[model samples]
Target: MTLNRRQFIGTTATMAAVLSAPMVRAQGKPRVVVVGGGAGGATAARYIAKGSKGAIDVTLIEPTRKYYTCFFSNLYLGGFKEIEDIGHTYGGLAAGGVNVVHDWAVGVDRDAKTVALAGGGSLPYDKLILSPGIDFVEGAVEGWGLSAQNAMPHAYKAGSQSELLKAQLVAMPAGGTFAMVAPPNPYRCPPGPYERVSMVAHFLKQNNPTAKIIVADPKPKFSKMALFQEGWANHYEGMIDWIGDDFGGGTVSVDPNEMTISIDGEVTKVDVCNVIPAMKAGRIAEIAGVTDGNWAPVNAADMSTKADADVYVLGDASSQGDMPKSGFSANSQAKVCANAVRGALTGSKVFPAKFSNTCWSLIAPDDGVKVGATYEATPEKIAKVDGFISQTGESSDLRKATYEESEGWYTGITTDMLG
Candidate 1:
C-alpha cells in the first residue's frame, strides 16, 4: 500500500493522538511519567499528584536514590555546608501519592507512549516530562574526557564530583596553584562556575593562604561580573587571577596526567585543575528525538516540547528563551507546567503561566549577590518582564541581609521541591 508522505504523516498524527488519549489506558486514570527527579521533575510530579487528588496517575523516575542539588554545592567547598545539606530523597513525593520509581529512563517510545526503564519494564503514559539537567559536551575541552575526571574533576554535577574536587583543593601544597577551566556561555547556572571560584578562594584564604587561584573563562564577561570582581578585590585581593577571553582564556587544554594546563600556548603546572566543559541537554532528551541537537525546545506556555505535545522538557534540558538555566528557573517552570498538565488531564482551573527566578551567589562570609527576573509566556518564548541585581558597592549590612534571604529561600525551596 503506497501512501503519499503527507498522508502517512497525517495518519500517524491521528494515531498518536488516539493512542495518547486518557481513556485508552487500562488504569482508567490518565498517567503522567516524569523523568529525572531534580528541581523541575520533583516539583512537577508533586504538584500534579497533589492537585489531581488521585484523578491522574503520576510517576517519577530517577536513577539516584539521593538527589544532590548543584545549587549551593559551592558552599560545601567553602566549608559552609555539608554534603548532606544538598541531598534530598523521594520519600516526600511517595507519601504525596506520586509513584516514585528509582530507575533510569533508558528510552522513550513516543509512538507506543511508553518509557523504557533501565531495570526491565516499560511504563505507559499519556504524558511524559523530562528535566534531566545538563551533561557535558563531548570533547569540549581538549585532552579531557570522562576518563580523566578523577584527575581533573568537573564537579559540575555535584555529589561525588564535588567531594572529589574539594579533596583535591584541600590537598594542594602550600603556595601551590589552582586553575579552573570555566565553561562557555548558555550553560547551566551562569554564575555557578564563578561562585565556585569565590568559594575556592575563600577556602584557600583560610587554610592554604599563599595558594593562588586562577580562572580561565571562555566568556569575556560573566553573570554578575562587576560584582564578582568587586568582591574578589575586596576579599581575596592578590589571591586570584581572572583570565577572560581577551587574555586567551578561551583557548585552553589540560594534561591530567601531568597536572598541567595550557592557556593559549602557555603551559603551567597546577596542583588542582577544575575543568568544566561546554554542556548539552541530558542524554534522555536526545534519545527521545525531541532535542535540537543540544537542547529540547519547549513552548513557554506549558513547557511542552515543540517536537511532541505529549512530551515536555524542563530545566537545563529545555531551550526556553530568556531564563538562565538555574534551579529557581526550573522550579518556576515546573509549577507552570504542572498546572497546565493537570488542567489538561482533569479539566481543572489552569492559571496563566507566570514565571520567576532568583539566583544567589555568596562571594565571602556574609557577602552575597543576586540576580533575578520575572517572565511571562509569550507566543514565541518565555520573555523576561523585569529584573534586578545586587549592586557592586552595596553596604555590608545589605549584603548580609541578602545572604540571609538566600538561606531562607534554600530552606523554603527544598521543602517545596521535596514535599
Candidate 2:
C-alpha cells in the first residue's frame, strides 16, 4: 500500500492528464480531497488550489450544488431578505480549477486513505480537510424528531426550516405566542438564538404588535446578552420574554403536535415554536472516530485531527477553544489547514498559523451587534491573543455600518472560497 516514487509520479501524471483541459489545473502536484464544501472546506479548497498555482490537484466533495450561509438567516425569517440572497453556487470553485463533486460522503476509510461517496465511488487523497458542520441531537427533546419538524421547526441550520418558521410567524394571530427553546452552552453561533428572538420581535412589533416571543433558555447567560436585552427594551418594549435556567423557562420536552413545550415540569403551548436542540459534530465526523464528546479534537498547529494525522477537521465541527463556531472562524481555519496540507504533501516547511473570527447579529434593520477574537497557536493549543465586542449603547449609525461591513465580509469570504 506504500506509494513508491514511480507510483507517486504516475498518479501525478494521471491527475495532470485528467485536468489538462482546465486552464488552472495544477500539474505534477499532489492530489488533495476536501469534504464538505461549506465555509471551511470551500475556503481550504480554494486557497490550496489557487495558492499553489496548479501545484496541487484539489477536489471538493460536497452534496449540495449550492450553499446558504447561516449568518443572515434571521433576516430571511424576519422578512427582510430573500432566501436566494443567502444561496451561492459552486461554479466559482470549478472555474478556479477545483473538481467540485456533488455527492454526499458516506464514510472515510482512514486505513485505505480513501473517502467513500454515496454515489458508489471512492476518492483517495494525500491530505483531507473536513468541515461538515453541526448535527442536532435528534431525541434531545422528548417526542421530537424529523416527523415533528413540520409543526415545531428548529431553524438552527438555516434553510427550509428558517422559511417555515417565518411563515408560521406570519400566519400567527395578532396576540399569538412564539416560543423559542434555546440549547445549553457551546453550540454553533451562541448569540444566534437571542438574535433570532430580536429579529422575530422586530417583525411582530411592526406588523403584529400584540404578538409575543418567549425564549426558554437552558443557560443562565448567552453571547451578547446585555446588548440583546437592551436592544429589545429600546426597540420592542415588553414584546420579548426570557426564561433562563433558573426560571421555569428551560425546556425539557416537546409535543410538536400540540405546539407545547415542557419547562420546569410545566407545559406551555404556543402558536409557533422554534426549538433548537443540542448540537454535535456532524455525523461523518462521529463515524470517522474523530470526535471527542460533542466535537472533533484537532491539533491547533494545523487543524489536523488528534485521532488521525491524515484527517483535518475545521469549522463548527472542531473543538476550537476560545473561538466560536462561527463562519469566520471556519474560513480562517481553512486557510491555515490548507497551508499545512500543502506543506505535508510537498515536504515544505509549515507556516505559522493565525486565526480570526467575527460574528454579527442584527436586532433591527440597521441595528447590529458583533463579537470577534484573534488566535495564534502555541506548542500546547490555539490561544486567543486579542478580541473585542461591540460596545454597548453604540449609536445606530455605527451598528448600521457594522451590518454593511458584515455584508462585505460575506462577499469577500465567498470570493476567497470559490474564486
Candidate 3:
C-alpha cells in the first residue's frame, strides 16, 4: 500500500521477523534483539544496552537511519517548529554500545530462534523484544494505496510526508479547501487528527484567511472534543468544518491523483487530501503468530507475549487497554518492558509494573489540552487507576504555560529515547 512518511516511519516487518528468527549464538552474554526504533523499540534498546553495561549484547533492527517524532509534528505544520527540531538520530543508542542495523527484517524462524534479514543474513538472539508499532489496514480506504500517498499525504509518521504536506499547504491558493479523513476509534492518538486540523487551520488563518479546513471523522465523539470545538469557534470561527460519523463523515474511497475523497458515496474534490486508514499492528507481528486480533497479547506486568515466553511486545503492537497509542505511552511501556526483561535475564526479583501516559495537543499557538492516566497491572489486563484531563475554561496563561511544559516534555522524551 501507499504509505506516508508517518506510516513509513512506523513500519516494522523487518523487526518482527528478527524477533522470531532462530539461530546459534556463542555462549557468552545474552543477546537481545529489539525490532523497530521509533519510540518504544529505541528506548528499550538504549536502556537495555546501557543498563546491562556490556553484560548483555543488544542489537537494534530498524529500517530507517533516523527517527522523526509525531508528538511535535503538528507544531511544524503550524510553523511553530522546524523539521530538524522533531527529527532525531540513532547515534545515542550506538554510543551506548548498541549494534544498530539499518535494514529490513523479512522473516523469523521461531523454531530456531533466528531472524532472517532482507540482505540474506540471519541474527540469533537469546531474548527478543518486538515494538514494531502499527500498520494501516490495506482496504480500509478503497482506491487508496502507496501510489496515492504522494498526492495525498497522511503526514502521520512525521518525516518526508510531513514535509510534503507542509509544502502543499504553502502552495495552495488563498481560499483552497484542505480535507482530512479521520480514522476510526482505537487508532493511534485519538486527538491527533483533530489537533492536526487545528494546526493547519491555525496556519491558514494567519496566512490565508479565506482558506478552510474540513474534518471527516468516523467517530461522533473524539478525545478533547469540547476543548477543540471551543477553540475552533473562538479562534477560527467559520474557518473549519467538522462532520461526525452520524453526519456521514466516514470515507469509503479516495482517488489521490484527483485529490478527491468519497464520503458516503459522494465525491468531494479538494486542494489537499489527507487520508488516514484504519490500522493494526505491523504486518510482521501478524505473520509471527503474536497477534490475537489486530494487536499482540502480552502479560500485563512485563509485556511478554502470551503466545511465546521468549518474546516481549510493547507499544502500539501490544494490546494496552484504555491507553491511547501515543508516543508517551509507547515510551512508558518501553521502560517497563526493559526493566522486566533485565530482571528475567539476571534472575532478579520482578516488581509489579506501574505505567503512566500523558498526551498533549495544541488547539492554538498558546492554547493546549492534555489528558493523562496512571495504570496498574491486573491479572487480565492493564487497568487505569487515576487520570486527569485539562480543566475546562482554564486561563489562557495557564494553557500557554502548559504548552511550554509540553515542549520541555518533548525534549526530555527524545533524550530518553536516544540517550
Candidate 4:
C-alpha cells in the first residue's frame, strides 16, 4: 500500500525500532547498528547486510537526510562541481534491505549494547559501529563559535557553509583580502586546507585579480607542501601568502565581530575569514565511552574499538594508525570492519585485512597532486607498507591525467558508499 510522506516516515521508523530490538536476534537474525551514515557507516551497513544475505539485520542511524561528502568540496569552491554533485542519499542503502533511520544517536549504553536516539527511541544490537567523523575543539580559536559561522564560514562540512564561502568570494570587494586559519596536524584531511587555498585563489584570479589570500597555518610543514607551493607559484603567482608557524602563524586569533584576524600580535582586517579549528572525534563516540583522548582508539585489523571488541569506530573518529583522516581512509576501514563483523555474526570465512587510501588535491585546472599508501595490519597499528606522492614540477599531461583520475574516483567512491 502507498503511504504519504508522514506515514512513510512513521512506518520506516517503527520498522527500524523493531529490527533493532535485542529480541529480534532470538528470531534467528543478528542485529548490527551503525551510527553516522557517511563513508564509513554507509559502507559498513551496506556490506554487512549485503554480505550476510539476510542472515543479519543492519540499521543505520544518521541525522541528515542527505550526506554531502567532504572530499572534493574544494572542487566545489573552484567551480569544478555543483552542490548536488557531492550530495548522496540513503535511498540506495535502504533499497538494499537495510534500515536507514534518520535520527541523531544522542547516547550509547555500552553495558546494555543499545543506542539512545535523540527522537526518544533505543536500538539494541549485537554489534555497534560509530563513524560520526569530527567535531571542532571548543577553544581552538578564541572568539569563534557556531553563532559566528555566518560572519566567517568554515565550510569544512561541505554544504551550506560551502555555498556561503563561495558567495562571499564572489561578492568580495576588489583588492580585498581573504584569510584562512588552518588547523594543526592530525585533523581531518591533511592536504585539504592547502587545496582550498588553491581553489579560492583560482576563483579570485579571474573574478578579483587584485584580491589577496593569506594563510595562517600553525604547522611548520604540511602534506604535499612542495607540490602545492609550486602550483601556487605557477597558477596564482604573488596572489597567496602562506604564513607558517615559524613566521608566527602559531600565535593567531580572530575577532569575528570586527572582521579581523591577529597574526603574531598583528591584527589584519580581512573581508573574509575561514577558521578551521582543531578537531576531535564526534560526540557519539565519546558518549559510547570509546574515545581515548581526542579520537577513539581502534584495532587496525578490524576497525573494532580497543576498549570493546563488539563496538567499532571508523573514519575521522578512529585513531587507527598510518592513515590520514579522509573519505578514502574511512571507506577502506569500513570494508575491513564489515568483513570482521559479518564473520562474527554469521560464521562466515573472514579474509585477511588489507587497506589502501589515496588523497588527491586539485591545485588548478587539470593540475592535481596526490599522496597514497598501501597499509597492512600489524601488532602496533596499520603500518604503511608502501606509498607514493606527486613530485613538484610534474608534466602537465600527467597532472591532467591525475585530475581525471580524481574525478573518476569521486564518482566511483560515492557510488560505493551510497550503494
Candidate 5:
C-alpha cells in the first residue's frame, strides 16, 4: 500500500510503545494514572504533578504524542488560526516532572485500581483520571458509523480528522451544498456545531460565495441560539439554512454512499457532509465500568465517578451537570479534581470546588459572541450560580474584543493543559 506524507505523519504521530525514560519514584508516593491527554486528562496530570512537586507519582497514558485542541479548531477552519496553533505536545508536561506514557489505555481493573495499556503493560494507581473525550455512539445516525467517517467526517475530535475535514471543505465544488448532521444535546461544546457552521460560511464566502450551508439540528434551542441565528442572517443571509426539531431534525438519516441526507422524509444530495453524531464517554471509561451507559456520572465536588471514587472522569466523558462539555469546563473540572486528589493522597490543603465555562463562537472575521457561567457544586449536581451571554446585536468593537479574549483564552488553555 502507498501512503502520502500526511498519512505517514498521522501514523507516526504516536510514539513507540516502550516508554524511554522510565520514571523512578521515591518510596510510597501516591500513584496517579491519567488516561487520555486532551484538555481534561492532560491538565489533571500536569496539575497533580506540579502541585505535588515530586510528592505524587503521576503517569499520563495517552496514545497521541501531540493533542490538537478542539477549541479554536473552528478558527483554523475559518483561516484565522493555523493547524500548528491548535496542536500541542507533551514535552512541556514531561519537563515539569510528569511521566508521560504514549500508550492507549485498553482496560481498567477497578477493584485492583489498575489501568491496562494496549502496549502489554498495566499501571497501578491510587487515583485514576479518565478524560478519554468523546466517541460517537454506534448507529446514532442510521446508515452511519466509523466506517462512513471518511465519506462524512465528524471532525469532532481534533488532529488528523480536523485536517481531513478542512481538506474536504477546501475541495468542495463552487456553489455546492454543505450539510451538517448536528449531534444531540449533552455533547462536547454545546455551541460547537453552530460555530462550525459560521466558520464554514466564512470560508465559503471568501472562496465560493455561491455555496450554501444546511444544518439539521436535533435541539429546538441551542446555546446562544439567538446570537448565532442573528449573526448568520446578518452575515450569510440566504447562504445558510437551519432545520430544527420541529422540522424533523430529530428524525434524520444519512447515506454516505449516495452522499444524501434525509430530513422530514425529504432527501437532499449534498457535496460535503459533516456528521456530528451522538456522543458518549470515551471507550476506556465504559470499559472501566465507571460510566452510566453513556457518560461517567461524576460527583460534582471532585469529578469522581459514582461507580468508583478512586476513578475520576472529566471533559466530554463526564456527566456532571450545569457545566457544558467544553474545553473550559474540562480545564476547570481538572483543577478541582487535582486539588481533591492531592489532598486525598498527600494531605495537602483542598479548596472548595468551584467551576466555570465560557463558550465563544466566531461568525465572521472579528465578529464573535460568547456565553459563560459560574457554578457551585450542589449535592446533586453542579448548579449554575450566575451567567452571561452576548446580546443578539452587540457592537462590532465588543465583538472584536470578545474574539480577542477568546484568542488569549486559547493560548492560556493550551498551556494549562499541555504544561
Candidate 6:
C-alpha cells in the first residue's frame, strides 16, 4: 500500500498498535492528544497537524463518529434546517493528518501526560487539549436529573437530544404548553435558551397556533435582552410568558412523571418541558484536575490551563474571562492555542493571541439578531476591546442581512473547524 505524507502521519500510530507496541517516537516528535472533538478540540488538532506539516503527531479523542453542532440546533428545531445539515463526520480531519479516535476519554493522568480511553487503551502526549464542553450540574433543577431527560429533554448537546426534543414538540397536543427551565449564568451560549425560545415559538406558531410557550429563567436579564424581547413581542406576541428572577422564576421545580413545572409556588401541567440546569465543565476537565470546581482556568494568551502548562483547556469548559461560552468563542480560542502549542512543539513562529466572537439568533423567519465583540489577551484575562449588537426596531431588510451573515459564518466556521 502507498501513502502520502499526511496519510503516513495519520497511520503511524495505528501501525505501532498493529505491532502490539506503544506509539513510536523515534525522532522526538511532539504528540498532542485532544479530548472532545467539538469546535475547540477539532480545530486545535487540525491546525496543529496542518501547521506542523506532519512534524507533530495529533490525535483527537471523541466518542461520537458524527458530531452535531449545538450552535445551530435551534435552527433545526425551528424547521430552518434538517438534522443531516448540522451533522458532521471526522473523515476530513482524519484525512488532514489528524488521527481521529472514536472512543470515550475516561481519565487523564497529568503526571504521565496520557489520556485513558474507556475502550481500554492510553495515548501519551507532550500536550493535551481539552474542550469537552458543558455538563449539567447535578440537582441544579429540582425534580430534574439525567434519568428524567426523556421526559424533559435538555437538547443542549445537540444530536439525539435535539431530535428527541423535536419529536416531543411535534407530539404536543393541540394548543398544549411547552416550558423551558433556563440555565443560570456562565452556561454555554448565554443567548441560546432565548434563541431556542424564539425557535420554539416559530415552530408552534406555524403548526399549533394556539400552543403556548412558557420560560422560567433564573436570570433577571439575558444576552441581547432588548432585541429578543422586541422580536418576541413583534413576532410571537402573547405566545411566550417569561418569568424572570424578579418574578420568582429562579425558584422552580418540576415533575417529569406529571409533566408539570412549579414556579413561585404555582404549579402548572406542561406538555413538554426542557430543563437546562446549571452547567459546569465536562467531567474530563475535573478528572484532569484542571477545573476549579466548575470551570478550567487558562492563560488568556495561549489557552493553557493554569493547573498544568502542558495541558490546555478550550471552549465552553474554560473559564477564560470575557468570552461567551459559544462555539464561535471556542473556535477562536482554538486557533490561538494551536499556534502556541505548535510553536512549543516545533520551531514555528508564534503569533500574538487575538479572539473574536459573534452570536446570532433567529427570531421568526427572516428576523434575526446578533451580538459580537473583539478581544485581546491581557495579563488579567481576555479583555473585550470593542463590541456591536443588532439594535431594536431595525428595518426588516437589515435584520434579514444579519441572518444571512450568520448563515455564511456557519458555513465558513464548520469548514474551518473540520478542514
Candidate 1's displacement at residue 330, Å, is 0.4
Error of 2 at 218 (Å): 0.6
Span of 10 residues, lowest total lDDT, candidate 6: 16-25
**Clashing pairs for predicted structure model 5, backbone only:** none
Off by over 4 Å in 1: 1-27
TM-score result, candidate 1: 0.94
> Clashing residue pairs, candidate 6?
none
- For all the candidates, what are their Cα RMSDs to the real structure? 8.4, 6.3, 10.4, 7.7, 11.2, 6.0
Model 5, runs deviating above 4 Å = 1-27
Which regions in candidate 2 have their CA more than 4 angstroms from the true location? 1-28
lDDT of 1 by residue, 345-392 (tens): 766778999999999999999999999999999999999999999998
TM-score of 3: 0.92
**Whose lDDT is higher: candidate 3's or candidate 5's?**
5
lDDT of each: 0.94, 0.85, 0.84, 0.92, 0.90, 0.94
Model 4 pairs in collision = none
Candidate 3 lDDT: 0.84
- Candidate 5 per-residue lDDT, tens place, 311-358, comes to 999988999988999989999999999999987876667899999999
Q: How many clashes show up per model?
A: 0, 1, 14, 0, 0, 0
Residue lDDT tens for model 4, 1-419 = 88999999999986776655433555658889999998999999999988988879899999999888999989999899998988888999999978999999999998898999999989999999999999988889888998888999999887889999999988899999999999997999999999999999999998899999999999999999999999999999999999999999978899999999999999999999999999999999999999999999999889999999899999999998999999999999999999999878766768988999999999999998999999999977988989999998789999999999999999899888888
Per-residue lDDT of model 3, residues 197-243, tens digit only:
89999999988899988788888899999989998998899999898
Q: Which prediction has more favorable TM-score, 1 or 3?
A: 1
